[model samples]
Target: MTINVIGIGLDGVVGLNESVRQIVERATVLVGSDRHLRYFPNHSAEIIVLEDILETIVEIRQHLDTPNSCIVVLTSGDPLFFGLGRLLVTHFPPEKLRFYPHLSSVQLAFSRLKIPWQDAKIISVHGRSMDELIQALQQGVEKIAVLTDHTHTPKAIASLLLALDLPIDYHFWVCENIGSEDERVQQWSIDEAKQEIFAPLNVVVLLRQSRIATNQSLDLANLPWLGIPDSYFCTYDDRPGLMTKREIRVLILAELGLQPGQIIWDIGAGSGSVSVEIARLFSDSTVYAIEKTAAGTSLIEENCRRFQTNNVVSIHGNAPDILHHLRPPHRIFIGGSSGKLRNILGVCGMRMLPGGIIVLAFTSLENLHTALSWVEERKKSDRSWNYRLLQVQLSRSIPIANLTRFTPLNPVNIMIISR
Candidate 1:
């Protein structure tokens, strides 16, 4: 018998599909993280907390090749998002893996908050950084939901937002143990949220549209990243520039349709090109940048300072991991995800507000195909998701036979999503 990987959303067993629930209940050998296993501690199935997933995978594989072993791997939220189902599929064929997914924890958070989440930006900042999150806010995304780990507490998130000078009057909802009997939900001001104790396993919902009447450079909905050029500040390289293209960026911004002071995430910020422009466009908004590269993080700070925008905050870390720990956003974008597309979208789908918007930029067609496949799957369980294709061609005046021609560069794909 092969291993059966199960995805446990916020509701734990209560929200699981019948087949998935049956799989967990009937499993003779259950393996999960301590927290996940504890959710079903009373189950008669034998359980083991998997601390080292690599080691656990190896052991599970050995048993999978055996005759009578019933192995089940449990995960928090969507296993495909930051969960283990995908990992198992990598080592084995599709036929060898069975995935049972539940409504993600972020979904439960939204339900508890009673906010329509169709258009929210959802991200998991568990072990990743907040650079991207900051950038998104600067661009004016309105509603955001964050899947948090232990370190990315609401207080830590609040401190970061304060440092960035985001509007202090926005609403903050910290939901603990969503879908569980002891579930607790608290709403507070940015300052007030800093004093509370939030559960390690929790979710954050941020509402960026409080006063609704602040005037800014760009419409909160049309906030653009990388709108301002990289040459506006220092950079690690001197070629094309350490930033997303302005023309395409403008379209992405147009797609976002953000509001003033909305929460946003710019994951994998290379040079704060997106973050700075977002801050500049929405002076009242707070933008978070998640950059793992040292030069990139430094560049974000440098650019923000050079542009005199105080709404940008750069975090030095990776995504999904770092993303899980930060506050959620009304708009979420993956500027640089290091090829972790499945995990990225899973987190986004799980954490995005029901009515939130998500934008994914792809420079190549192959990746665009892959992203489409992933997004298509998300549309199945999730609500209505709309996709748009923007093929941009820009030209600069050059001495081409005494004439400047607008040579079409490779087409870039910008996928705008609405939940």
Candidate 2:
């Protein structure tokens, strides 16, 4: 006996092609939700309402024992596209099941809007957590199609988007009753979506307005005095979390002991997070953010503009080689040394202004030892040179079901060297 999973749309029975319609007509048994079952009320098949899925599966097993039973399980949209087909495959053998997929709501949604969906990120919050949707938003994906449920409605998603205070903005589109007679596709502002009511069957689409953050709308006065949130700055597309996190940035900023009119060099600046923060704090200070990758340099410049930190000069070149062209620094931050920690340290140590402080952040023990060795070798030549180490470990709270749990960040060992 084979379980034929036929994909239906909001348009119901009339939407099925002749070939698929014949399969449904010859079925000896039928299983589906109340909505899906309503499409074929006059059918003579033995009906099973999918209220308790485990119980329904047991009934299906019993029906399978019959020698010549044809079981048809109805589902909405493409059965394999975040639908019931996955569950059926896990419980039954591949040979015992066949799938006839209709157009998915996401596909219908994009079609209604006349938007190409090949690159769109599809997320389903229907009877599931919104963790994936939240992560997609954080990443600032170009396009997204979200299948929502009663709890995670369009309005709720809009509210969550506004609350995130993201660097980028999205054009919110709600497609309701897609592929049905009463289908409605409308674009709404993030604020307007919060006050409106949408149909029960709806898909939320988010299209990023721009690739870069909207810096003109940024209210710098409202920003924190120190350690700006990581979300405010636009890092690399591939390496979003590569920049110095806020927790560690705070410690690095404190160790720098920043003062006005000081020259600061941020070596291996991933996205200029440290440079921008220092520039914002002390406008008189000049921050030279040296990054090797062109993409990294572009991101550093973009972040500088986003935060309106004009004092930050983004330099696209490797450190030590690039350090010689710049003015001697009163403070140095080594966020990344690019496997040349010794050379960077030698240049920084020799060129630094008297009483200048250098803070290096390391996640690897090997790099930490390299810096320690470099400092020890330098201490013999200069008695005033000395270093201190601080190991930082931090964790942030995250929701786990009804309770909260702590998720630890990467451990960092900070080496502070001063004369």
Candidate 3:
């Protein structure tokens, strides 16, 4: 009833220690992939190919019931690191299992490149979505090590990075067949990487290039933070102060109840002030800034770079027209909706997660009434939403002729709807 889950390096059986080698030799039942089992062709143990994980678990359970039986499950790299060891431990009793881990492929790859990996972000794309990889890149990490599979190869990763239009420069290192005689490590630029194919088993490492200092260094310390001065943002020359005011933006952010890993949408994101702040507040979250005007979209991009908010993605298109293409959001902020306020609200209400929050900032009574009517209509059918309205009127102090005078700013109506 005893089981030993051992990790094997890419070098195969030769990489095992004496104790692990003896355990494998004396095992009554062996479980692993076909490639792993081929390493012990002359062994007399009962070999089970791990084609279906569920079926293999059932088989292992049956074998454990037999008296005086020893089971050894072999996996690549560190068994507990995105490997079968953790899964087996979850299904089986912990006291009955023992784990012997080897250097992980991530470690071997980093070692081959002579790079310190303690600070590097490690991710695995084997039989998983590439979204996590994209998110990591957007976070502006200095270095990353990605474990890739056949479908999510190094070349595909390179193409995805290029498509995102990432501002930071990166050098891609493709490490293939690690720890074996046929091992290969090659460095490539983003352009050169997309043109070549790599072995199915490989690790893709992205190292950000260091930036050179210039006159622009003075602005680095003045990066905007929460409730940043409105003057910091670039607005249309003719339509200055068009963006959300600092005071109201702080309130809207508080109402949205931002959380880590949540997806947020900023419709009609003028200059993307709100979206950039949200990305900064929730560094792990994804923020999509949907703006229609060409100038507005350009401003958002410029602001994102200026603020070093790489997590914010600016979509240059009208909302409700392009909302269908984006992932469902946990929080949505509507700054300007043209006349489609009702339609945009409906789409957001439908796509937002249950218990999600939606906040709208309207300067016109017509838009405010439109939102109120939509909420009232939805309330009749579904009572799950809670609504609150706040009107903000403020004045700023300006010094004139050695005397301070108060200048009143435009009033805004904020409508918050939460499910």
Candidate 4:
């Protein structure tokens, strides 16, 4: 027996093709919301108004137990577009299910706007955190489409975006009653949209603003530091910037090389840059930022708050002395230890599993040699051990010859010793 989930579009029955209609007609029992259920102008399938999903599952199972049982679930506008298709697919194996999909509401929204959606960032804030949606927006993606909910309605989004100091030039297109007789599409600026009322059912599209956050301060309020001139990153006098430049940060964090449910230890965490960035990128992983110096500890905490990361634990204790007490971590990052290179590496080296990684952030050749010698000694054992240095040089943009050009920035040497 096959279970089919057909995608319904905003155009209602008119949008559905002939094949999907046949699945509905032959379905032993049909399941959908009343509005969706009414689409079958003529059908012999026993209409089952959906209420509790478990009840529907039980009803389907009962039908399946008898003989030939075919269940067809109908949804509006691409069942996979924040729809019930996922739930059904999870409950039934793929071999037993077939899906007929219509263009997703997001596709329709972008189509109606005559915009290419391939590059657009689509988010469903229906039952999600407003912060996530706002973060994605702050990253300055080219286009954004939001599937809104009653509590997270268009008005609510408009109001929140306005509070975020959304640019005045960016266009907000509120699509309502789409593919319906009473359909109304309203366009407004962020300020105007805050007051523009619309029905509960709506999709919101945010077009790229003519200008970026040129005037916004570099703070949590305005994130991803997008469009901010290269002058925004906080650089220490005569020293490299606290965090890896944005570009390097993205790459190395990619290489911290975490596995699912893995534990990571970041020693000598200065400003918690690596730790905070990793936490933000991999929200599910646990990151420990170890720092001892009063200034270093303060910097780490400040960065954690600055990056808006809730995943890192900033430990104010010193290393080696602190390494002994930690539950063996799967990954370790030693940020150029002040002393006890052998002792700390021995302890961390032993703590890690067979293939676990141990990264060392070192600057000076003396420190790098010391780290290499220690790892080399350990490599003599049954375990495999190796070390590397990340000679990172970063540059940022500045006005030169009346045009913004990247200048050679700071350089740092990061070493990775792993087995």
Give the TM-scores of the predictions, in the order they appear: 0.49, 0.86, 0.54, 0.51
Candidate 1: worst-modelled 10 consecutive residues by lDDT: 211-220
Q: Predictions ranked by lDDT, top down?
A: 2, 3, 1, 4
Write the number of the candidate with greater lDDT, choosing between 1 and 4.
1
Q: Which residue runs does candidate 2 get wrong by more than 4 Å?
A: 220-225, 229-242, 299-310, 363-366, 379-384, 390-412
Better of 1 and 3 by lDDT: 3
Give the Cα error of residue 172 in candidate 4, in Å. 1.0
lDDT tens per residue, model 4, 1-419: 77788888657777778877666777888888888887774667788787888788777666655567678888777777688877777777778777888888777777788888898888888866565566555455557888887677776776665544422234689988777777777787666766667886688998765333233344666455222222333222223234445555554555567776667898877656667766765778788888877666766676566556777888888788887776678888776477767777877877876678887655567777877788777778745577666787775443221234444544666666667
Which is the better candidate, 1 or 4, if ranked by TM-score?
4
Clashing pairs in 4: 8-77, 390-414
| The best candidate in terms of TM-score | 2
lDDT of each: 0.70, 0.88, 0.83, 0.68
On lDDT, the leading prediction is 2
Cα-lDDT of candidate 3:
0.83
TM-score of 1: 0.49
Residue 408 shift from truth in candidate 2, angstroms:
6.0
Q: Which ten residues in a row have the lowest lDDT in candidate 4?
A: 229-238
Please write out the lDDT profile of model 1 over residues 155-206, one tens digit for every residue. Answer: 7777655544332224778888877778898887778877777777778887
